[model samples]
Target: MKGGILLLRSIAVISSSVATIISTMLPLFLYVSTPNIELISIFILLIFSAFLIHGVLTHALNDYTDHLSGTDTNSPAILSGGSRVIQTEVFSVESLGRFGKWLSILLVMILLVFLMLGYYRLAVLLFVGLWAAVAYSVPPLRFSYRPFIGEWLCTFPSVLFLGFAGAWLALGSPPEWALQNAVINALICIAWVMVHHIPDLDADKNAVPPKRTSVVWAAEKFGLAWSRLPALTYYFLAFTCTAWLIPERFWAGAGVTIVTAVSALFIFKMNVADPVQVSSYEKIMLMLAILNAVWLGIFI
Candidate 1:
């Protein structure tokens, strides 16, 4: 039980669950017109399970990397120090590596089964998603160490692509409505990634190769200015996408948009007043994610 708890903490279970939920549900909500409720629920569960397993593998591998790199010392609460198992000596490095490798292989096999069931697009998408996960911290790419590329790759391929691919798999092909939702989803996803970095501002400064965005932004006023432009652009694109593609659900879409915009505004305002008070920003991100998923379900 103790070991199990360590594993769960290492994997950041709650965040991983939310990631799976967004990846699995957005696509279904957008593309599956007249969806069979029962079938959709099953697919969601399956996808969520797949993502959870992937997250576990990723967490293990990442922890191994951080241990090797000596970057896990004195990390922030939200920065995933990757020290849980390593610091506790619950698992040796060799054992953790073996676990990660086997877990990744198992995830691939499961994804292949989903593909054989006629979900061809999902199979292709899963490959890219897994690649991004590995590339984020692994050699030959280590893209996550880069600045802008890290942020966008983390946000787009992993989040946006998976969400879109899931929808395509469930619905065969996205309707204009689903496509519109995809745009909004992508924008929101980008924003979420940006805000997630705020919590890691300090640790990221000492990254070996040095992340450009983090360095530049940290020098600014509370890191708020760095994301302001992107955040505003995301909100604008979200509203425009919804307005153009979902005119029928205008009132609902507008309401959600307004709320999201306000939440963003509050985060910015609070950040400007006190950079230390960023818990509200995190809450706003969670709320936006939930509301975005709910709106897509209701409107699409």
Candidate 2:
């Protein structure tokens, strides 16, 4: 029973749910200041659905596929490796794969629910999120095994949709401000995710099919010292967006700017050559990314 509990915890990866929570709450705060009981109840269900899609299904496929491709097997076993359930011997690869399949079915059921309710927009967004998670890790597409494509095609859109989720569900469409904020949040997310890839470079390269994340590709093309480029590039993009928005949303923009600047500095100073050190820094990066999301939700 104890082992089963720990295995479940490993795959849950609940710590990563901060982005979904913030994304859901942002629209609720902006659109439903005094939401009725029905709206609030629906909001709660929406949050659950988001978690089911992202935190559970996404991680399930990721952990299962990475294990199959040997990336997780060779992973540095820090923040970068897939969840450590398989490594810890609490779950088998087949079991994890089965879990992913079950979750996929569940996600489709939720998507159908939205469709039946005429929430076509929400259904489409959820479908996109599902596609990203599957195509990113599963066979055929396996975008996560390639550089740039994974983050840009998979991670970016999934997160952008998540940021737009609350507003879309509540207002039936996100306002300009919400859209801009969603873009910024997505940028910050991908930026930090790039950093998260740094420590896994060696493990990824050594994987069976070679998970050449953008960070790994940059390191090979430029040098390990330059692996920071991909993350820095995204962070700079996020910084530029926030800077552009400063004139309109002063406090919110300023909050993101300060946190982004600090995060970029950390990435700049990161010792990319040391997997252990880079792994340690990823926790801090994750914190800053969450802070950016929180600030956007509250102040925007």
Candidate 3:
């Protein structure tokens, strides 16, 4: 049971989520954006905790539903599949399901408290987040399995909701610069999901009924190599626009993007035949660079 609980925690991928909220919050922290912004407060920390709880809820529920639907068992990929605890029998699926449900209830209760505090917009966004987190995997609206449509539906919430929730709470109404940055970051977030799906294309296609995710759809329509083109193209557009947004850090950002492109090329060579489980590495590099570049461009 103890081991099971530990494995459950490991799969939350909390650190990545933390990176997201942190980078999103970075814009709010800048002196030029929120002049004389209150540096620290109990409320800010409470909001931060809420974001983490929300992250945990998303991961836990996603794993539970995927396990129940047999998707996790059908065709597992290293980076994108639910944690294998259920498949391995490390924990009963029932127990995992209960864990996710309780987490959901806890998050809803927190949002209600925020509502009572009269942060209407913040609460509403968080509620949308709660819905997206659950519905991403649940039936009647299992967005994750919806192929091309699912990609935007699933990625938009995590980035937009979590990102804006932090920004709105911090700035009340974001200025033009902050708003543009949020939208750009959200686009990058959406593109990042494509990066994730790239490595999972073959695995997802081999599923029981073949889950045709965006990457799978692209691979089917245009071939796997062509599927890679859209994502690479999106990154260039993102970084080019980002360069304009923060010209001082333009080259720094481009440098990171260049390194990621090079890394992608090398990874391509490493697993040319199978497409293996290698695209996940490039995704990680791109994400880290985005997070790091935010700091370099905004804070540094």
Candidate 4:
């Protein structure tokens, strides 16, 4: 049980979120003539902690909701469905419900503190971010199941809000460069998120009433390899944008995106070889993009 709680603590993959925040925020850390190092440091600390807290809350809520729906019972998607802790009986739904609610309250309190600090816009954005996270799996408005809108709801707010938050705190506003990077990164996130759902396509399709992830829906409408076109398109666009915006870092960014593109070409091969191995494919693209961002920051 203790191990399970510990697992839950790390299960939402908070490191990736932190990494994204840092990657997008990297420009602020490096450029900007007269920077507030101390304030930027403080913002990083608070925002980092906020992401951790928010991860816990959202993941717990997701586990509880998925458990109720019996969705995770047979799901094998490592990155999609909720943590299997509840499905494994590691935690009770009641306990998870209590934990999620308490964490939500805690997050709200932190937001209130941010508001009191006069960070009005940041505070409002954080509030909206939290709502989107919770709404991803919560009832009635289960954004996780809402198709493309649901995908946007889950990905953009967290990525953009945090990206903008980091820039806003450091630069007083998200610069055109940061905003461009934010949009590019957001597209990659949504793309990889769709990739993440591919491994679970069969599981989702076989479910009662069927859980239609983007890949599942795509494959239904288009053929298998063809269904992956949109994700591939997003990846290429991100690569082009990175190169166009910062041609100096094209090699660094291109190295990763090219590898990602090659991997995508073979996705059908991998998916067939190991139906559940898509997490590696999804995560690699994300990690490389993150690395590309960091590399871009360093050279600039």
Candidate 5:
């Protein structure tokens, strides 16, 4: 039973789940000056919970699908031995499938509650979110099998949807700042995904359903290596544009830009030398969260 619980927790991918929630909430924090604290708190909790459920369902479903497709068997040694839960018998295949279904259903129910509370936009977002989660791993529309599409899909929600949702929830409407910031966030998220893929190059190639980014990365390692540049450039450009256009908050924007630049440099160096290092990824992600929080504090 204890082992089962551990496996379930692993399926949840709690660190990634928390990062998603934080990314979503940070945008809201930045855009709203005096949002209703209690309501905002509840919404954050609900969204975080939804993401947790989504993560668990997505991982479990992916594991089940991989097993069926024999992708897990062909996975590289690094991924197969060190990372993959399903391949190692961390949980029974049947149990994982059951958990996946139940968790996905529970997430949908939670989204319905959001609709009941007049957060219709959030409800709609949840619908898309659920679809993305399932389609990424399942058959028929397994977008994850597609090269570039999978990476974009994986990162966009954290960057765009979460940021927009946060701003919308905070201000009760979408503003230019919200939209722009969301785009910047999305770029950053995409860059992060590209960097993370540097390590998974081998495993992704051998999988039954080959990943797009993996192929792309293999073909054009240099191009993929420089992928983070555009995102970093955008972050700085956005900050600069916002500062010049909205002079009152110029300092704040510039400050965030400086931090983003420094962080991007660190991330770029880490990716160049050791993409597979878990600590590097964690540190970069943590810095991103902090930078986002600071940006929100200044803007909202």
Candidate 6:
């Protein structure tokens, strides 16, 4: 029982749920005004379905693939390594792979249910999540093994869709407010993830096949100091989005601006070689992101 619990928690399912749940719930709060039983039910289902695809399938596959590539084996970071289940011997590699495979089958079944029930948008969103997960870590098209391709092509779209999901489900089509929120959230998500990768730069480079994340690529091409470039570029982009929103939304925009500044500062202060400090900063940034998401929803 303890091992089972450990395995589940190690996957970071709850952590993954934070963005999607807030994204969905806030839109429901803003648009519905008073959510009916039907709305509540749909909300629950959407969140559950997203949990299946992202929290379960995506993390599971990523851990499995990273383990196979030996990245997790070499990782020194506290937070950015693949789930430490295989490293800790909580589960064997074969067992983790099977766990991911079964969860993927379950996700496909849920997708079919959405299609049959005329929830085409939900199906499409889930498919994006599924593709991002598989393509990110799987062979051949292993986007995460390359540089910018993984974050821009895989992580960005998946997170953007998740941000758009609540608004789409509530309003049929997302409003400008919702789209802007989604874009900001997606950009912030990318930013923090890049920070997460910073601590793993050396380990990623030394992986059997080389993880070659954006941070690693930047360090190799632009020099070690430039390793912070990928994450800073994204934080700047997220800040730019808030700047555009300030004219129409003073207080909310101001709130996000403060949070975004703090977030960027954490990255700026981060010692690229210090995994402990980077991990500490990563935790704070995550809290700030959740706060920013709530602030966005409240103003919406």
The lDDT for every candidate, in the order shown, is 0.58, 0.75, 0.58, 0.63, 0.56, 0.78
On residues 3-68, what C-alpha lDDT tens digit does candidate 3 reach at each position? 344444432233234444555566556553454345245236535554454445665676676666
Residue 237: error of model 2 in Å?
Answer: 0.9
Error of 4 at 270 (Å): 3.0
Best candidate according to TM-score = 6
Q: Which tens-of-lDDT digit does each residue in 260-296 have in candidate 5? A: 6766666556654344463465355545645654464
Score residue 13 of candidate 6 by CA lDDT.
41
Candidate 6: pairs in clash: none
Q: TM-scores, in order shown?
A: 0.75, 0.89, 0.76, 0.82, 0.70, 0.91
Candidate 1 lDDT by residue in tens digits, 1-300: 564456555223333334434544654545555466854675665466444544566567767766665455445544345537877788887888787778778869978897889767667666766776677767656665665565466545565554454456555664555555555666665555555555555555565644334323544544545545445455566666655744676755775577567757765575632334654565666666656755665565
TM-score head-to-head 1 vs 6, winner: 6
**TM-score, cand. 2:** 0.89
For residues 192-295, what per-residue lDDT tens digits would candidate 6 score against the true structure? Answer: 88888988888889887899999999999989878889988988888888777888877667876887789878777888878899888888988777778778
- Model 6: CA > 4 A from native: 1-17
Q: What residue pairs clash in candidate 2, if any at all?
A: none
Clashing residue pairs in candidate 3 are: none
State the local distance difference test value for candidate 2.
0.75
By summed lDDT, the worst window of 10 consecutive residues in model 1 runs over: 10-19
Q: Candidate 6: worst 10 consecutive residues by lDDT?
A: 7-16
Question: Which stretches of candidate 2 lie above 4 Å from their native place?
Answer: 1-17, 20-27, 30-39
For candidate 1, report its TM-score: 0.75
User: Candidate 1: which stretches are off by over 4 Å?
Assistant: 1-46, 78-83, 87-94, 108-119, 212-240, 272-276
Give the lowest summed-lDDT range of ten residues in model 5. Answer: 75-84
